[model samples]
Target: MTTEPSQLKFILSSVLLITCGQFHYTFLFRAI
Candidate 1:
């Protein structure tokens, strides 16, 4: 049960990081 939760958290964090990276790139592009 503990392993399951940890796996889920890792997946969520990875997805969030990817999304944040894309948003940052777009924001920078528009600022230029």
Candidate 2:
């Protein structure tokens, strides 16, 4: 199967969003 550029971008953006959310939660915990 061939990968589409837009589909790859969507996956990357979602992964980034999830990582950012995790990082934000960790920072908040550390600050408390």
Give the best candidate by lDDT.
2
lDDT of 1 by residue, 1-32 (tens): 35688899999999999999999999999999
lDDT assessment of candidate 1: 0.95
Off by over 4 Å in 1: 1-3
RMSD of 1: 2.6
Residues forming the 10-long window of minimal summed lDDT in candidate 2: 1-10
Candidate 2's TM-score reads 0.87
Cα lDDT for residue 18, candidate 2 = 100
Residue pairs in collision within model 1: none
lDDT of each: 0.95, 0.99
Instruction: In angstroms, give how far residue 17 of model 2 lies from its true place.
Output: 0.5
